[model samples]
Target: MMSTPVANHEAIEKVRDLIQGIDNAMLTTMTSQGLVSRPMKTQEVEFDGDLWFLTKKDTNKYQEMLKHPAVNVAYVGKSYVSIRGEAELLQDPSKVKEFWNAAYEKLLEVPYDDPSLILIKIKAETAEYWETGNKTKMVKTLFERLTGKESEETDLNKTVDLD
Candidate 1:
């Protein structure tokens, strides 16, 4: 039987927690040649089914997103989360100021008000996560591996819909 979609608040919060601990994510985008992946610093904010990042409008990633908005973002923390989403490029000055930080001065070597600076908003459609267990469970899993027996606790993988 097909499993029911996970659209509850608990599932969304679980995804937010997993991604909150991750500082960087590999954003995969499509290109004419093939798929290109880049490491992007995630904006620090409460996750609510969307993600944000800063980039330049002239960059190849921006062009690729314009061509193909479908993207995948993978985060690795205590758990692993893979998010499939659609990306939109935005240049709203107020939002730029809202998400801006002093660190951008050092990283971008320019003020936040620079016209070239832009934001990428990814509206997540679905997210899947693999959460590892605690030390006791880890030990049990190790024993099971050594004994060539499958473990009973195998419900760590979950997929949540962010629609």
Candidate 2:
């Protein structure tokens, strides 16, 4: 018997792990003029199957998302993850509470209970990730070889698709 490949599940988990290490992501969206990218803070909640963010409903980013739901979130740390998804503005209190934290109160001009506060829910449909070796490690290995010293080989580059 053969088993079906669980690519989606495995990929999601990998992306989630990367998110844990990096709390910042660049959210790219299309405007009537052109593409715009904004640095957004990731929610404190876990990245289960979706990515969460808080923004103001009246902001340019929110307006852009409303006009074009298609979006891409890029996160870089030990690896790089590019997630493609459709964004939806959420206003539910329960959901807001789920992702809300006291730290966010100072970040936003409006209160958490403010109706203008919108939650951006990204339903990721696909993702791509690239893992590269640390900068210091790579440089050190190159220097060792140049100095006639033996250096251990390592496989550093890896690509993964989550779709």
Candidate 3:
């Protein structure tokens, strides 16, 4: 129930650090069938209030984002971060080249100039993160849970407003 709003530069850096360690994230989109989530490789760039991903323009995810721009991206590592954001499909060739690499060429089997290649820019609005402490603290939490005792830890959860 403890949620601190992160607005300072230091706090923002901490959030960015946590996300930098996570290589992949689950992107959830709303469709006629309900909510659909798929694993997507996170772009290796400094987090600056937004996230980016590369996907085919003809994919269902691209269509879904067009219909319902609202999406959620979940990341897990030493900490868990849940970001609620809006996605926009961009065809900026310069941006594509900025994030392009040899790995992308191997995966798509096509050059960066391919027509189907597009970028998904997610502008994060609000994000919540839960960071767990070291092994000793984790063990204590487990012990408290097993004994049916309420643990007293209030500094592990935080929320940031990126807008």
What number of backbone clashes does candidate 2 have, counting pairs of residues 3 or more apart or in separate chains? Answer: 0
Relative to the true structure, how large is the alpha-carbon lDDT of every model?
0.86, 0.80, 0.86
lDDT of 3 by residue, 47-162 (tens): 88789999888799999999999999999998888999999999988888888899889986778888889999999877888876585786787688779988886355688777
CA lDDT for candidate 1 = 0.86
lDDT of 2 by residue, 1-163 (tens): 2223586677777778876768799999999889999899888777766889998877899999988999999998877778888999988877776777777788886566878888899998777766655777767776887898888945434445544
Off by over 4 Å in 2: 1-5, 136-163
Give the Cα error of residue 79 in candidate 2, in Å.
Answer: 1.1
- Name the candidate that leads on TM-score: 3
Q: Which candidate model has the greater lDDT, 2 or 3?
A: 3
Clashes of each: 0, 0, 0
* Candidate 1 runs further than 4 Å off: 1-6, 135-149
- Candidates sorted by TM-score, best first: 3, 1, 2
RMSD of each: 3.4, 5.0, 3.4
Name the regions of candidate 3 deviating beyond 4 angstroms: 1-11, 135-148
